[model samples]
Target chain A: MSRRLAAALRPAAAIGCALAAMAIALALLGASPLAVAADLADGAFGNWIAFTDTLARATPLVFCGLAVAVAFHGALWNIGADGQLVVGALAAGALGPALAGAPHTLAIVAIIGAGGLAGALWGGLAGWLRARRNVNEVISTIMLNFIAAQLLSWAVHGPLMEPSGAFPASRKIAAAARLHLYFAPTRLNLAMLFAVALAAVCELGLFRTVPGFELRALGRNRRASAFFGLPIARLTVGAMALSGALAGCGGAVQISAITHRLYETISPGWGYEAIAVALVARLSPLGVVPAALLFGALDNGSQAMQRADGVPAQLVYVVQALVIIVMLAFDAAAGGGWRELLEGGAPDRPDATAETCDA
Target chain B: MLEAFAASTIAMATPLLLAALGELIVERAGVINIGIEGAMLAGAFAGVAVAHATGATLAGVAAAIGGGVAINAIFAFVAVNLAVNQVVAGTAIDLLAAGVTGMLYQRIYGATGRAFTVAPMRPIALGPLARLPLIGRALFDQSALVYLAFALVPAIAWTIGRSRFGLSLRAAGERPEAADALGLGVYRLRWIALLASGALSGLGGAYLTLAYADTFVEGISAGRGYVALAVVIVGRWNAWGVAAASLMFGAAIALQFVLQAAATAIPYQLFLALPYLLTVAVLALMGGQADAPSALGEPYIRA
Candidate 1:
């Protein structure tokens, strides 16, 4: 088989394995696996509304997945995307009211810009620590995620709390600041459009731009990159910041378009799941699109599975975990297609020796 | 006030110390086991389920150890044998634990009202030590796990730093190829380290449900496992350092309780962030990458 076809088949085979495992699990629960599968399919793609909602749900994942994918290409672990996302949501929510008096375009732009900047700062902090201080990004990012959670709760409950004091959430943004709802009843909005556009941008930035080449070069061999005069520290920080900006964009889109206001819980661990999404996509920016949608469908379908089949909604988390494991197995079995995928299949792969384990 | 804080700090530190010490061993054996969290969660679930079912805390703790071992065995298979991405595999283990535990809790307990609550393990007071002043009483009077956790520090420190096995374990992590060339059986050494760490991590988890909280809450392990990860870093991967760092984090938790009770103006979330903030702050101060094991996250293959 062609390497590309084998690469594509790897994920498909992994998905099949994951489904079989879930089927066995369902049997243990005394539920019909076939019925659960049918219900899940129905919930995710049964009708136009379900499909649209699935796409709507996929929007945030697309952005976050791309964020993770881009960072992973440079051999960076940006687990703080979740924290960055929350800060994005918080920034947009806090700024929404202040921008009500401005023109619609300016108000929207400012909210998005503020959100992106907040995310960038958060991501940049970890990147800076990794670059300058030699701190491990994984641990720092995880700690930052905890701090971000507290910050979100503090804001929701203390500062930007609703006027009525009945709920732990900020007041809904001014109607004008909210993104236009497209294909009503499905929560589809302009944010999905932006996510798609950004995915394209990420593709160009990673493969076409000079900075992208340097970043990829750094990822391939830091020793060589440094010897060749690449600014290793600066590129690391920039890639991380840009990665955070994308995730922050996700948080902004989610709050502005779907939630319409910041709440105590804005995401159901999309940032964590985005790791699986990006990894499964082999760190391909374009590949992240379908992978995100697959996750969205799993999430959307889990709700249906719960409603129609008496299964616990937490089943989706199980499937997600299984997917990551299965994908890793497949990638390993393929003798490191993961590295090739991340390096975007260049003719001269500089990172042939790079192991997927670090990621 | 100081005495009360000191006593609570010991309580909070036991679990963190156990997990960190366990992670220390795992990292020393060439595997950065992120799945320590998952193993701890499994132990937590097993401890609560068995204790609640059989009405024996000791039995529950044993089962928890077994559960932790089982989870780590899977980790060994993937990380040591298949040589998959350790972070992704570890994360998958965590998610699997969360989902399985949550679903089982819901199915068995029915997602409503108070779930089954086991009797919290009573602290055992050492004869004369219990009668002593503030420091003595707090230190000597504690659950068996607390004592085990503290005692393990020297035991672990010696086993890792002085023993022949210790040299081999470090050799495996530092340079697996060299270790293998010397006929040390790198995979075998790593598996042993993983199993040992799993048992310790499990003991920590059981301490939470059977001794600390005395009940199971969904995701009750919470961020403690991850906090233990930070503690490993803050501890500089040393046993005594782990104890000190864990105590510091324990103090952070105790301070949160004291602060929350002292005022209504300050949001409780600020205190919640204390340990995490401390972790980041410590990492910032430490400078970086000088202390990490060379082959810490690599999956060793007999290349």
Candidate 2:
């Protein structure tokens, strides 16, 4: 097979292996894998409403997937995309009620823009820490995710609670700020189109821009990038900010298009799920869409599968985890970029206590 | 209030201390398992399920250890044998554990999401110490797991800081190629460290359901695993430091409970967010990876 075909086939094979593993698991749990699979498919793509819902669900994944791809491409281990998205939604939700009388277009822009900015700051905080303080991004991001979740919980239950104070949710956004559904009675909206456009823009920016080149170079060889006069600190913060903006915008879109109000659980672990999406796409900006859709279909279909086959909807998370594991194993076995993919540049930081040379 | 706070602090610190101690060993052996949270979750679920089924807390604890080890075994195969990126593989492990545990919990307990509780392990009070003043109940009156966790601190400190085996583990982490060249068996050391870490993490998970909480909830590990990761760093990768860091975090968590009960003017969410915020702030202050294992998080394959 041509290298391109082989490359394309690899992820498919990995996904296949993951499904096979899930099949065994399902069978052990006394559920027929085939029936479960059929139910999932019937639920996800069996009808127009289902298909539209899948796309809508995939929207956030697309945004967060891009966020993961951007940051991972720079070798910044950002495990806080979910946190960023939450902060973004919080910002948008907070700003949404105040935009009641504003022009429709302006209100929409303000909501999304606010979310993106909040997300940027949130992500950028970890980035700055990594750049200046030498704090590990992985740990910092995870901590930030917890903090973000608490912040949202506080918002919904306290300041942002609906006026009736009956439910732990924020007030609905103004009609002007809402991204109206394009198809009546369907969840399809302009957010999906915007996401697609952003993906294209991200692909272009990542490949065709000088800054993008610098980021990838930094990811590939951090020491070399530093030695070559690449502004390591600047690139780190910028990539993280951009990544956060993408995820934040995703959150804003969800608020504008779907939920229209804030709640404790704004995201369903989209940030972590995006890791699988980005990895399956091999951190490709353009590939995130399809990858997100695949996972989204599983997510959208899971509830139906649960009802039909006595399976839990969380089974999709198992599929996601398996896909990632299988993909990583396949890639490692195939002699792919395991080192650079994770450790970024040098595997070891210079330890003043002992080791002189690092692997 | 002081005595209650002190006891809560010790109770809260136990799980973090247990997990952090395990991670310290894993990091010392040159592999960082981000999946510690996943292992703990699996342990928590398995402990509750088995104990509920068999009416034996010991059986629950055993099952919890096995659950954690089982999760880590997959991680070991992928991270150690396959030489995959440890962080991503660990993340996958976390997700898998969450998915598996959540699914099984739902399947067995029904989809209504009712609370499930088991008989909690009884506390064993030390003879004279239990009857003493402020620190007595906090220090001497606790479940076997609490005492074991604190006891492991010095034991782990001595084992890693002084033992010949610790030397080999450090060698593997510092420079795997060099360690391999010296016949230290880097892969073997890493595998052993990961499995040991898994068991400790599992035990920590069991402590949650069997001793402290007496109930199992999905994601009950609740970022405690991550906090333990931070504890290793803040503890400066030593057992004593880990113990200290865990106590500080435990105090923060305990304080939250106390403050929440008082129903103060302050928002409860602030209290809930305290420990996580502390993790970030402490990590920022700790700054730099100067004390970290040289080959930590690096994939090492045998030649």
Candidate 3:
């Protein structure tokens, strides 16, 4: 078989192996493997409502996934995306009510900008630390996530909290600021369209722009990029900040479109899950679209599986873990031959080695 | 007031010290095991489950080590062998552990609706040492884990600084290629370091369920693992440094609780956030010249 074909088949084989292993384990536990698969299908895409739910759920993943993908493409790891999302959502929640009497279009724009700017600022802090001080991004970002969570908790329960003193959540956003549902009888909103547009813009910026080339170059090798006169330090921080902004936008979308208010635990670690999504997509901005959807389907369906097949929703977490493991295993076994194909059969690959470093 | 604060601080610092020390060892050997959180979680669950099942705290401790080793083994294979991204692999392990433990807890105990409680490990007082003023009670009047954590600092310091094995481990982390050239098995040393870390981290987890909280709630580690990671950074990869950093963090955490109890005008959540905020500020001021092992976080593979 041709090398490219073999490369394409590797992931499929790994998935087959993973599923077979899971099936055997389930069977040993006295659960029908076939029944579980059928239930998963029924729960995720069994009906229009289910499909819409999956789409709605996938919305945040798409934003976060794209965020991670953009940063990963630049060879930066932005582990603080979760914290950025939280801060973004908080900004949107705080701003939404204050802009209640404003024109609908202006309020909506302000909310989105507030979320994106808040996320960017949060991300920018990490970037500044990394660029100016050479601090490890991973450790700093993770630490920031804790601070952000505590900050959010403090806000929701203290200053920004609803005066009624019910749950740990902010007052609801104004109707003018909320994103309208794109379709009737479903929670899917125009934010999905925005996500799609942003993903496309990221793709263009990564592959078509001169600055994108520089970012990709820096991602591939800091030394080489510096030699080529690319502002390596600046790019690293910028990539992370941009990545965080995307995640922050996702938080805003969740609050403005779905929840219509900021609540404690707005994300079930969507920022962290974005890492899995980005990795599974091989850190490609365009690839994140489908990868995020797959995660979305699993997440939306997990509850159904719990209710119907007596499986825990945590099973989705297991599946995600499995996907990352299998994907990495397949990617490693296939070698750079697959990566070359992933890079569109480019023989003179500039970023292949750096990409491997990223993985 | 001072006495109470000192006592609680010792209790809180024990787990962070144990976990941070474990992480320090692993990092010194050139591997960043982000799976400490997963290891701790597994230890917590296994420790509690075994304690409840066998009614022996000793067996629970043993089971916790075994569980931690099993989890680390998965990380070792994927990260060490497959050359996967260490951070991503570690994150996956964390998710996997969280998911599996949550499911198992539900499957085993969800039906009963009764809280699973075990006999807490009894504090071992050091007779004469326990009678001394504030220092004696805080240091001597504690469970075995607290004493072990304190002793571990000097023991680890001696091991890493003075022993031939420490030299070899340091050599491996500093330059795995050179270590390999010198006929030292880099992979084996790293593997051993990870397993040792697993044991200590597991003990830390057990401390949570068996000593600190005495019950298994979701996310019982409560970002302590991340704090441990920062402790390694702030400690600058030294055993004594880790101990000092852990105590600092522990004190910060304890002060939060004390302040919350005092119910001052300042919101309790602000106090809760103080440690993390301090960590970030310290890191920023310290300016990231951490001097981490050269090969730290990079998987070494034999060509």
DockQ of candidates 1 onward, in order? 0.51, 0.73, 0.44
Which portions of model 2 miss their true places by more than 4 Å?
Answer: A337-339, A346-359
Candidate 1's DockQ: 0.51
Q: What clash pairs does model 2 have?
A: none
Number of the top candidate by TM-score? 2
For model 1 chain B, give the 10-residue run with minimal summed lDDT. B107-116
CAPRI class of candidate 1 = medium
Report the TM-score measured on chain A for model 2. 0.95
| Per-residue lDDT over A1-359 for candidate 1, one digit per residue giving the tens place of the 0 to 100 score | 99889988888888789889999999999999999999999999999889888988899899889888888777776777889899989999998877767887777788888889988999999889887777777778878888988999999998899899899999888776788887677687778788888988998998999999898877666656766767878998999899888888888888878888999889788888898898778787988899999999999988898889878888888888888888887777778555433322111112212233233
Docking class of 2: medium
Candidate 1 or 2, higher DockQ?
Answer: 2
Question: What is the C-alpha lDDT profile of model 2 across A1-359, one tens digit per residue?
Answer: 77667767889999999999999999999989999999999889989999999999999999999999999888788889999999999999999999999999999999999999999999999999888778888899999999999999999999999999999999999999999897978899999889989999999998999999999988887766766778888999999999999999999999999999998988999999999999898888899999999999999998789888879999989999999999888777776453455544433354222221132
Tens-digit lDDT track for model 3 on A303-336?
7777877766776666667777777767766668
- Chain A TM-score of candidate 1 vs. true chain A: 0.92
Residue-by-residue lDDT tens digits, candidate 3, B17-73? 988998888888877877888889988988988998899999999988887888888
> Which portions of model 3 show Cα errors greater than 4 Å?
A6-17, A337-359, B111-113
Candidate 2 per-residue C-alpha lDDT over B168-264 given as tens digits, one digit per residue, 9 for 90 to 100: 9999988999999999998888889888998999999999999988988889999999999999998998999999999999999999989988978
| Model 3 per-residue lDDT at A333 | 62
